[model samples]
Target: MKEELGRTIQQLRKVQCYTQEQMADAVGVSVAAVSKWENGVSCPDVTMLPVLARYLDTDVNTLLSFHKKLSEAEAASLISELSDIFFDSGFEAAYAFLLEKIREYPGSDMLVLNGAMALSGAMALSSTLVMDGDQKAAERYEEEIERLYKKASESDDPAICSQARFMLASRYMGREDYDGAEALIDMLPDEQAYDKRQMQANLCLARNQLAAAGEIEERKLMLAANSLNMVFVTLIEIAVREGRLEDAQYLAEAADSTARALDMWEYTAQLPWFELYTHRKDRDNCLKTLGSMLASVTDGWNYTSSPLYRHMRKKEGEERFGPRMRESLLSAVEHDERYAFLRDSEEWNRIISAGGGTDRGAGQDET
Candidate 1:
């Protein structure tokens, strides 16, 4: 087992284009030490096994030839690393490598599950890319996603099954198969210990899609509004992306009403008022409302310096439309010291700028 582990370690090192000297340097050992370990003349000390495993980007057991002896957490970590490689690297390479590993670790369910997850993630990524252009590739990705979801659903673990169900619903929704998606959602246990809000959101989205396909405009509007309010914060995002300002306004109003109905002032406070202001073109009113909202938001988190705030300020100064309003909003966000979490994220800047690297013009057409 030790010899096999040494061989595997050597193989992975070569695959990563690392020389014995380089590997030794990374693991804090001598070149002769690495050579001796690889040749099975000697093995790394127990304390160094973790460092070696980490450098090799494999599990310690895999490097120590004790695949069958790993704890559950170790096994899970191995699966996770394999999934990352499969998703981040080319499919052909990941597939070839997994096929080899499966032959060696045929009894390992963790290995099999990781392979499924890797395929699913890859398919989803490919589908998103192709859905923007190549119809055939998009369809292929959808098919592969379904296949992987089915494989995952066969697991007895509730958590795994719930994830599979969610992915299946998402894929079905992507294909506009609302009925099939809803059917999968219906199969989920009511008391299942999963992310209930997310499941509910998916169901709401499915219902909205179905309503949009129906004959009743009033019913469609109501369902769409209900769906939007149920997940208003996210719906605002979708509306903005689709350049559907009127839709955003409708959803925002609905969200406001829903929040009132449920007495969820805190949640309602998080809904972006600037969205409604943008649609209404009531710049002064928008600024006033934004001031209040920003104050409340800052009160909740404590104002801290954030990349988003800085970007917003810069864009506000540069852009002609709503520059003053944005600047005011930034001041509101910066007024308190509790909202420190925003500074932790580098993407905050991109988020505030709509990822377009430009100041948004105020009166541009929705498209």
Candidate 2:
């Protein structure tokens, strides 16, 4: 811990191009004391933190890092609190709050880690609202996503580093930077946990540990379900790319049916149907499908009659896509270049007309 403090002091001082003697003079300490602190041979008194922090232009918390280690439970609680702040206030406000937290505990890799997660989640929620020729918001979000992941990549925590590298690779894939993505992926630790888990499961079975075996079997079942979802997802993506719209829609429905059976959270699974309808210029069917799909998910009277919804949670901002997020997602679909033809259609206009002052509730889907 003392060694870490020493390194922090040295790094901050060097970033400002300050020598040991200069730092000591600024903080009214001898060069020998500064050298000892930086060398890990000695630590500074608590009383000297303010002076040391001022000289380094940092907070005492940053200088001390974590004087006492945070428990996993405590860290999880903090993560949840940060998430709530994000949903309650707004992205900008949550970002400001996270920045302050990072400054306060500069060495807390979890802070950088959670910030990356929050920003990444916010990007998805915000992108739904982006439309053609209005990409300013999307650009800002992607830039911040890159910045946060890059910061997390430098974290000391292995878990934090691993997740950051993977997310960075994903971002590179989105940008078609295949080489960059491959480089990032190459830095990740190889998957050993799978082998270990299988070994443990085998051991449990051999020992007649029925309870343990059941838990392992449950985990294996979950993994199998996820694998099935991935396979179908890839096929659906291929269908969409190939312009096999009907096939894509069918596969999507199949996937969603399986998803609902597994009690998983569902998102906008019908957006592709809109694209297909628009492509065929079948305005009426397109609008009907859109209206029905929207009706199924939104927190409106339509949900009351839908068999897909048994009892809906009315939590304000905790849905798979919350009210604002759903609205934004719909806007993104509306402005997609492929569906621009629908923008002028009377069927589309009908929904637009309904979305006036008389029907402005975030999730009020009315035909």
Candidate 3:
């Protein structure tokens, strides 16, 4: 607690453009005392704490570095806002916004961890752009992200520490710092005694929160169904690659059947068949599959109708591309060189003119 308090004091002081000597004068303490407090070598006298906190423009709780702890939903909402700022305004704007929030909630471990994540993503995106000063901006963002990750890694919350360490390991790996990556990876647990979702549900049940437990189980079921669908798709891909077209067809059917049985998204059910038909250059089937894929996106499908996922609710900030996504899919098919064979086909034209495949397309007929 003393160490955390010291770090917070130093951070706030620096942020307010205060030197140790200046802080000492403002708080009526010696420069040496301020240095000790910042270094965690000693703490401020009890009476002087409020004075020091006032000087740093923060309250005692913030100064002690336990002012706030964001709930998961709050953190997710904040991250979503940051992402919108990064994409719409610019990386600089997003970075400034996150910095302001960090100053406001210096003791929020989730905020710090999520801010680092947002910065890391924006920095990576900027690095990929061939623009002036992008390299320098990426470097600056990287330094701040690393600092925040290191700070969060020291948190008492195991979840925050683990996420911070994993992100740090990823950063190291990106820079070819193999030894650093390996060390961080070694700190992570290889297995857990119980899955966190199930454990949480059990806890809810113990507390007689039956509805909450049911919701958790419903979410778990939805995730399991999604994962199973992906496994089937992956096996189909591998089968096709190994010249096992027959096996691939069988797997694709299985994947489609599984999606229907689980009440999965319409697009997901058609995905495997699209991949398979494209690989075999089956133009007729490809056009049909593409139409079904586009129809799903345009028609607005959700899991609410699914009996298996009835208790699960959509999370705030979940990605929804809307009509623009359908347009992009249609545009890709119309212009991409890989789809040249489908471009002039009568079926392709019909599908496009009808504004992407209708409900009569592939998955609809199959199910």
Candidate 4:
């Protein structure tokens, strides 16, 4: 509290262009006292708060408060920082860190929503605590996480409110609280008409912001394409499970073609075929699909190569893997027994030797 109060005082004084000496004189305190307050070495006496607030053109409440709002970029950055802390220092550290942030920005809807998400995700992974007989500690964390999400769900910002509610519903579902989940889900908008992205684009167009509107639509299109790809994969899995090999094959082909048409990464495009052929134990087709997949890995892929997504800027640190991805893939193939049949094959040897060797029709016997 002292540190937060100190920061508020320093920020307000700077905004008003007041020197420490000036603030000291106006508040009837020494320059050193004002400096100490700003540095968090000490705080103003209770009676001096009103005088300080008056000189700073703010009420005592405002003078003592932490910032209540965070810009979009600031919120994203802080969330990423919290994730790093969670990974590097462990859940307890990250939980405490988020608690401090929530205290510092009690009214920030973004902070509250994202902080809840971070803690909830970490808490899920910390289930070992419950198993280790620390049930009370885990329960406390769950209660706090739920409270934050509920608080965020009441925010005036519709996006934040909806997301918080969605997260709460998901948590309830995870715990088999079907009634709680259903109640929260019922509160959410279920139709396309309530989609904020399209609404934002429409508003932009109405304001004569054509370029902004186009960008929004393009991003939406990209996301929809990705979702469609996932649906195709899911359908293929279901078809295979139903013993409909022909249907599974057809869906796999459709998935592969859809990926190419949408300009998705070539490696991802070939994965459906790879999985289908591996399940069929079609050695030649498996080798062919694996060869194509490995070649794509060696060839470097990005959205810039896609005509559809070129205009969209990729987020920093978004790439899932780096320079060692190829090495890792090769190691996995060598270790996994599923690929044991392909180990001694000439095509496999060549493909492995050449790092997904040049286009080989060597295993193209599959009609």
Largest lDDT belongs to which candidate? 3
Candidate 4, clashing residue pairs?
none
Give the clash count for model 3.
0
Report the candidate with higher lDDT, 1 versus 2.
Answer: 2
RMSD of each: 18.0, 7.5, 6.9, 11.9
Per-model TM-score on C-alpha atoms: 0.36, 0.62, 0.62, 0.56
Selected candidate, larger lDDT, 2 vs 4: 4
lDDT per residue as tens, model 4, 191-274: 665778989999999999877787787788878877887787777778877899889888888887788788877676777777
User: Tens digit of lDDT per residue, candidate 3, span 236-348?
Assistant: 77998899988989888898999888888888899888878766777878888887888888777678777777777776655444464575577666655667888888888
**What do the candidate models score in CA lDDT, each in turn?**
0.54, 0.65, 0.78, 0.75
* TM-score quality measure for candidate 1: 0.36
Q: In each prediction, how many residue pairs overlap at the backbone (N, C-alpha, C within less than 3 A)?
A: 8, 1, 0, 0
- Estimate the overall C-alpha local distance difference test score of candidate 2: 0.65
Better of 3 and 4 by lDDT: 3
* Candidate 2, 226-282: lDDT as tens digits: 677777767766787798867866775676667557544333334444444555565
